[model samples]
Target chain A: MMTTETVNVQDEKKSAFLGSISSAFQGAETYATLRKSAWDTLSKFAIPGTKTEAWKYTRVGKVINHSWMKSHGNSQINLPEIAIGGLRYVFVDGLFRADLSDELTYPGLNIRRTGENAENNLLGTLSNHQGDWFEALNAAFFNDGLVIEVDKNAQIDRPVHLVFFTSEENTASFSRNVLSLQESSSLHVFTHYIGSEHSTFSSVVTEAFVGKNAALKIDKIQEGNETAFHHVDWTKQDRDSRFDITTVTLKSSWVRNDLNIRVAGENCHSSLTGAYLPSGKEHVDNHTMVDHMVPNCESDEKYKGIVRENATAVFNGKVFVRPDAQKTNAFQQNANIVLDDTATMFSKPELEIYADDVKCSHGSTTGQFDEEAVFYLRARGIGEVMARKLLVEAFLADVITTLSDERLQTYCTEKIQQLMHS
Target chain B: MLHIKDLHANIDGTEILKGLSLDIKPGEIHAIMGPNGSGKSTLASVLAGNEDYEITGGSVTFGDKDLLDLSTEDRAREGLFLAFQYPVEIPGVSNINFLRTAVNEIRQYKGEEPMSAGDFLKLVKERSALVELDGKLANRSVNEGFSGGEKKRNEVFQMAMLEPKLAILDETDSGLDIDALKIVAQGVNAMRSPERSFVVITHYQRLLDYIVPDFVHVLYKGKIVKSGSKELALELEARGYDWIKEEVSA
Candidate 1:
């Protein structure tokens, strides 16, 4: 529907935006080839418009129209106290703060700064930049991030906490992290994102590799004030490996999460679970895909949302079974509750199976609170508001209970209660 | 303890209870027997402040409070309970958690502190045993996947926990078997006190045999056309409601 003149104008705008940011990393020497390749891809593609099929529900005009400067080194703001006990790594304004972080001296675990380490072959291998704009943006401009590697047969007793705190206004921050687990190693990670008081944009990419017989679980929590947050996760699982990821989004003005998993080996298992609660004109979008490449693999995907006030939520999940992926089991479900009449929810569950012996199913449901259930609680002397809160808590219990960490579960439950009270 | 004067209610623009009147004093168990479509369930629902039924003209006073002006939860907080014919099934909400919330909220309404966890658990054990409810069912979701008998017994169990001043059982014996009916009746009988009153609404005299009522009233159409002692229930059961309908028509 666009004329040639409009296309030319859009191309000019895209070129100007890309040129402004690309100049900042002009003489950087770390990962020079990866950075140059990502920049080339970014220059070729403009920000996806509404006409784009994958981004049809989410509009990125706010991100493209406004000019954003790179965040500076540090801020004068105080660091919030950590609620869950673990080895904490803190990053402020997209730069690692060694003074505020714990010493990198855990047994059988190696932690390196991506900017300082130039020998990580797995750093830019898993993520696909050619098809994703944000992935390319993160790879091209990431200043500093963590590289975590677990030795073979090592089992981590304590969780690893990665905190990304932003305190700058009208700025953009990028972090690219790579996590690799050797054969038979097991690790649990908790990633927390805290935003600034003023409007900002943050793009984070994490690429995880689960070796044979390895187990990796990551619980991500995103809670911020007036921010645009984008997170991209790419994971590859080998034979006899397990991968699990759960993302809980409590607060944000605008957010988008893309999760992609590749089941490359047989006898592999993958799980993707998410719970998002958006209130007060907030917008949240979650897109996920799981590819079954071999036989005898299983994948389970469930995402729930509670949209309040005039907020909007979008969920799209896709499962693909290749021709050789016989005896594959894939299940996907998306459920949403729209609290107010003005709230909106868009849910699409898709399954593409190419093998004849595969078992696949997908379903999506969207509705309001059960009025009969509400009345049943109210008739027991509980107030209407409390009744509704109890129902919401019960609805999200299944997703929250899947978290192995008891403290994290309690923290999430309390956060939900506080948000409901607000 | 409870009074209703010339009560009129309508559901979906159709009148269900017209010019119905009833009165109950402290410690009295009154049985109201009626044929099908005689507004027995409608009266129970209207008294419990159900929003579906519009009170076109009515006056209901419970313990010096304007019952009609209170909301559904407020009615419960003011010591009024309705044992539904078909109990609602709420998945994922445990029965213990629900009862604890109800107990604390009711206590708060009375300006009392919340019950301690130890005492609350003890009370749950004691009250659940009163209805012969399985201990496992007490910890499960509220009435979810319960059988016909278990659901009815759960209704009685909840009533025992709330300890309302005026309890209205709306066809509690509809789907209950003989054993379940007796267990439910026994549970109700155990909770009877000098300050608590009951209004038992039923179709047959079977439930009255277990939980004897002091007075019996026959409802025809929308009003009580005949009022008598326990003998009236037996007479109506022995014969049918044809005499009452013919008497009302004449």
Candidate 2:
């Protein structure tokens, strides 16, 4: 008798949320059935709260109460350059722009829409894990997303850049990104998120699947107006696969990026690094999880942030080692530089290990610039501003060095400089 | 060129330099010898305008300007240099870039334009050779992973790049082999000119052998208790600071 009351309350909330999601996909012909099925699954699962182990530090309940289901129709918009120079893809209001994309072709690369029944495909199957609320939401309302596939043993010479642009104001955006890498294949992926000069909340979920012996390098840049809010969730990695991901966040009213990697095969490796330069009451949160489900897996995570003004930042990193996953090596470090006294950084690093013979270490540190170093620079006649900039550059150099792409590295450097000026 | 009148400074409620006074003119190198905790380093720091020390009482006049009123960087831009006793290592900033910034900052402060990249590189090469510093070391982070002697040498290289009017060497001779000592001293001696002055703070007379001083002052208990010619350094080295301490007590 008590269960009936709880079930009834849950059922009523689900139908309303589901109806909104279904209506958002009215014009899209390809994903109608998949959206219906995802909607049904989501109706059974409640939005996760902080009590969930994976969502402990991140409070998703606060985000659910907001009007996130509001749909943004086609609107006139202009996208700002992402400070990245390359072949770019521009998506305005979830519609791809042909003028911004190139028709050039490369060997061993295929970009096209999957079949109508691609709902049961490899990536779609993985997205059903735990029936994640955000994943379901993206699936139910995703208008158009590219399906990029790499051929086995093929090496992509140039890095592929994916740019997401939006101009809908006062509305939330739901977007999806799918990337798949074949065995022994190598590719570089750049995902740039740019918002129109408007205030809005943008929700994006990206699933990347790296096959055995495959290598993938990803660079994520998030730059938007300070009034903007963005949420990003990503999953998808395999055994003997190498995934290198780095994110640079410049400005956002509120930004949260969740990156989850499961190393299911032996000898897999992951290098995750993120740098955020937040100023003027901005906030940036980065949460990462690396699961060593198999033996002989390794991961190294380094995140750095330079917070000025009254900005706030959060970094939550967790590395999990299963009981059978012996011989796992994991290292994580988060260091922040607080320029102003009011700037604050919250860092939580956790290691959950059920396996023996594993090497894991995590550490976090937050502090102002070194007085001795500043004095040394000043003693050389360098002004206060330049001295602080030099120290900040030095602080971020190690993480930036973790990036192999020279173009991205230079671009990040210039962006950091500009952020300091701003 | 410089005058200190009854200079008294305190750090963390402890008075290190008490009523110290001295005078130096251009075309002269003055060596200040003292025992441990004798405030030799404090005098150099106070001269360079270190903000940590509170100047309870003192007047330091350099080239007709009140030295204590200026900030550390202002003092530096005004042609004052201090080769730290223990140089700080700033990781990930190339030595070349750091030196170039220092040079250009000083130049700009003097109302001169920044040096061109090529000219700056040329200056770096010339100054580095003066201290036996390898070009690769200049390209590496500032003093990062540098050996003890290499760190001291890097200090001299900076001194050369800035070419300040008043250079204070704070224990620059410490932690150096004989070869490094010679190279460092040669670099300092090469920069010597009638228009420049130096205040070398050291305990041992070994460094004075290479860079001969024109005047020698014995600092005792935060004050200069004895002043003499360069020969006084040999006497102090042979007899040690104990005799000087005894003389001050008497």
Candidate 3:
């Protein structure tokens, strides 16, 4: 039998970690409840892995086994550019920087720092083992997170950007955030993961709750240092609502983005798109799960990758339609262009449906540029290098067009161009 | 002028062109008529410096340089062009961009500066008009989603843009309708000049009617078995390739 002392050691360590996260909060009652619940859950479970079906390809064992991961331990981080134009919220080493935060409080918008309650009915009751260790660790140790509530009938035209900045050398950080939108509300929220050149692990788990008849547009852009190991898990959603999520991952030594979305209410629409350009020995993995649990839902997903040099890319997309989810329409396509023979890509588009009436399709392809096309271009007088570059640009241009923000689209296009030449 | 002496070539260890020889003056138009497997297309591909065909024995002289020694793109820059039987479709690259890169590459090979965007666009408009290609298609991806006839016409458009000294039409009329054949041939005819030459490879005598050749040669078993005036194409059209096979084997 395992002694209580053995379990208490683990619980004590978890509480110590939770203590660091609690320093960010102000209120007392909510902080005490969240700290107790986080400690209790951390005592019960360890990190999950391949035995967990949803995390089959995205391994979190290496992430959890690294004992260096802590709560960033009172270290001061001088944050970089957090705001682009309109809004900016900076987090230093996973701790929200209040001085750097802007207070443009407006109607129908409520922003507060809230702690997770020990006995919240839906948020903390169940363990999300669905095979992500980082997500489990985040749920177990997340003491404080942002709570965003968009009131009913509110339409926010300006984009809300969530900037997550962490720069710690040889130290690991774990952070969590949650956003909730009420009925008939609409807004665009952007999340950016920026870090410095450090041997660090930044595990972030975000949950978004979209009420019935709401609309939300989410863009998650990751620009971490090449030496950082970043794993981000997003539990985003649409419920009788419209939700769009786009991620652009440009730099990282090893990065895994796990995105899970559900059309929990009827007549919902969701679009998920991502573009990743990985170079050198870097590895970028994007795993997506879009569940159409209700009827009359539509989802479209397109992910493109440009892998050069010795970079490796993995894309696994799954769409599930429950038995009651009839008339579900889902389309998914993943295309990768590998420039060098040494570069590698593994892509799988999976469909699991129990509904009889649905239109579901998935396709995946990985190959080099067409040789005949190269010869055709060369024969017309184009040099070998210029021809290859043009073909790659043309391949990735469509995905860039999916960015609704004009400025983001232009920036990503220029980055892609520079990446191809690099 | 282009010259070929004792040219012998093989693909996949099987000889396709056996000791064939031909010569073309700068202002002449020549046609080589043969059945499906008589190596008519192989000769054009070889002259354009396609690497798949092995030259067992051959000497091709284009102006003052040896043709076979250069790469495919190098031969292209040397003013040799082959209008493919099936033009390759390059997705994503616009036709204008493709042509501009090709034109600039050739210019660079000649020790000239790159053409400006304005000058290149002007050249594209003028040349596209020669083939009646839509300006919209020129702005779209190269040959992607184009019809069979449109692809062949685009080949002629490229040939006109390059203004090569020697243009080899390798079965350019194979899959074209009469209207498309005439349009492509008209584009070729417009590019003809006293300082340029042509080699038209075809199976039917119909394309010969539009671009009449100064000399006609019958190729059989990889060699030119007979050479004559334009009337020989008419004679072969009347009597089939069976006689040429018999004459060559005999």
What are the lDDT scores of the predictions, listed in order? 0.87, 0.80, 0.76
Ranking by TM-score: 1, 2, 3
Quality of candidate 1's docking, in CAPRI categories? Answer: medium
Model 1 misplaced regions, further than 4 Å: A1-10, A24-27
Report the candidate with higher DockQ, 1 versus 3: 1
lDDT of 2 by residue, B174-244 (tens): 98889999999999998999999999999889999999999999998999999999899999988888888
Model 3: CAPRI class: medium
Candidate 2 Cα errors over 4 Å, as ranges:
A1-65, A68-74, A82-85, A104-106, A113-120, A128-132, A226-240
**Candidate with more favorable, higher DockQ: 2 or 3:** 2
DockQ for every model, please: 0.71, 0.82, 0.58
lDDT of 1 by residue, A1-422 (tens): 11112232347668777776667434557887788778766766667766666787888866666677777777766776656777899888778888888887799799998778565788889787766676878888888788999999999888889988877887777888989999999999999888878787878899999999999999998887777888999999999999999999989888999999999989999999999999997999999999999999999998998999999999989899999999999999898999889999999887888999988988899998988888878888988988988888888877887776888888888999999789
lDDT by residue (tens digit), candidate 3, B63-141: 9989888888888999989898888887667888778878888998999999988888898898889888999999988
- Candidate 2 chain A least-lDDT 10 residues: A1-10
lDDT comparison, 2 vs 3, better candidate: 2
Report the error of model 2 at residue A138, Å.
2.6
True contacts kept of each: 0.55, 0.84, 0.59
